[model samples]
Target: MNFKRFLKWLAPVSLTAILILCTIVQGWSAPTAAQTQLHWYGQSAFKLTTPTGKVILIDPWITNPVNPNGKTDLATLNRADLILVTHGHFDHVGDAMTIAKKTNAPLVSTADLGQALVESGYPKNLVTLDTQGNFGGEISLLNNEVKVAFIPAIHSSVIASDGSPAKYAGNPGGFLVTVQNGPTIYHTGDTDVFADMALIPRFRKVTLMLACIGDRFTMGPQRAATAVGYVKPDRVIPMHFGTFPALTGTPAAFAAELKQQRVGSRLQVMKVGETIRL
Candidate 1:
């Protein structure tokens, strides 16, 4: 073969290799409209776009401190099929009302927290009984494309707005979101390490884990690493840290601890306002 033909053959092959490498390093799949996409808005906020264009927001704190474009993202979001709030705290419940009002998204949460959100002005119709569940219960959402299970968390929950005395909002919790033809994501909400986490993978293999590494309020690097070991997800992303002075834990520290603990989970450090395909 002549040098010209050889070069032509190498070009597409080289491009394919580069794309694969990028996917491995960046935790991104091949760019396609039919792929499941995940967007992080700092803190515990996440938007998941399913393959069929259904949108689900988890702990929709769009205006958190770490997110610079919080307001813009909030305003531009025109569609939200479902909104899942792990608890009724202000931070975790951030912007849920605004988004739900605009998109008519149903709120998936424990029954007590759902009632509290409705009382706090969340759309009553949207917070219907179908979406409300308890711990150890799973609800099929978005035409069965996504299934969300209410998981227990070691945290407190209260709904307090405008300093008007906190109201009891049942228990804090996390979610196990299983996406069809996509990844099974575990959002750890704001919880410390617990033994039941070990039983999570027994049900379904976790593709991604959104874990809290913020020390003061939630699990630090060490405890978070232990939690990761229990679930053993395919990839782990650290969150709920660095938005405030009190949340001192960092992804760097979390990575070191994962290594020290001999946890085999792959760590994917997501930046605020970043999106990745799964």
Candidate 2:
């Protein structure tokens, strides 16, 4: 081979080797069966099962904010080994405390929000609070291969009770969940698409990405599509839309943009109360 051609091929090979080496050192290796499955509930809620039967829930809101539903009550939902709250927003945290109390699920929320929940009559013992501003920190659960990390998201947070503000939780964020026996799931709570999102890499090629597309409160479809490109998950599920009249965003538009970006095949539009197996 010519010198120039050999150097070009060698450069690409070297780059690939370096990336693989980094991934191995950082604990990203062969994906197991758990990395192939994920399930999404409406909005920013979902259930992820590890290959070892571990379940993790992210922002489990299953009711209407304007009018609560009997079936949507989180207290009666299935057992959750780990519960993640992206922020202190009421909609995102509507049923966290109730579910935690009922299932004795360890809540993974910010310290500020955990204290606020305790003060507002939530059980203090159920919370596994961690809000020390450690952006990329991971919390390994007691059972199951479920691990959760607090990722950065540009949004506001508040804790209220009986129609009054109880606490002002600081900046909102999202959860990057990784199941040792399964796929990595990223649930973006109410947030605007920020540049830092590309910093986090999923362990198992992100089988499911639960994203918020409701404008006014969160990023619109266009910005959300851009975020989809950045995260580049295997499948993207649009949520946090069509619940309210003020929130004007739709999954169809998101899908269209994804198509334009040549990622339409990865877009999955899940209806409220509908579940998609990832």
TM-score of each: 0.88, 0.78
**Collision count for each candidate, in order:** 0, 4
* All candidates: CA RMSD (Å): 8.4, 12.7
Which candidate gets the maximum TM-score versus the true structure?
A: 1
Single out the weakest 10-residue window by summed lDDT for candidate 1. Answer: 25-34
Question: What is the alpha-carbon lDDT of model 2 when measured against the actual structure?
Answer: 0.71
lDDT of 1: 0.94
Candidate 1 C-alpha lDDT tens digits along 1-278:
99999999999999999999988989856675588999999999999999988999999999999899999999999999999999988889999999999999999999999999889999899988889899999999877899998899999999999879899999999999999998999999999999999999999899999999999989999999999999999999999999999999999999999999999999999989999999
Which portions of model 1 show Cα errors greater than 4 Å?
Answer: 1-33
Tens digits of per-residue lDDT for model 2 on 8-125?
A: 9899999999999998889865564443345545566666666666666777765545324425545457677777778887777767777777787777776666666677766777
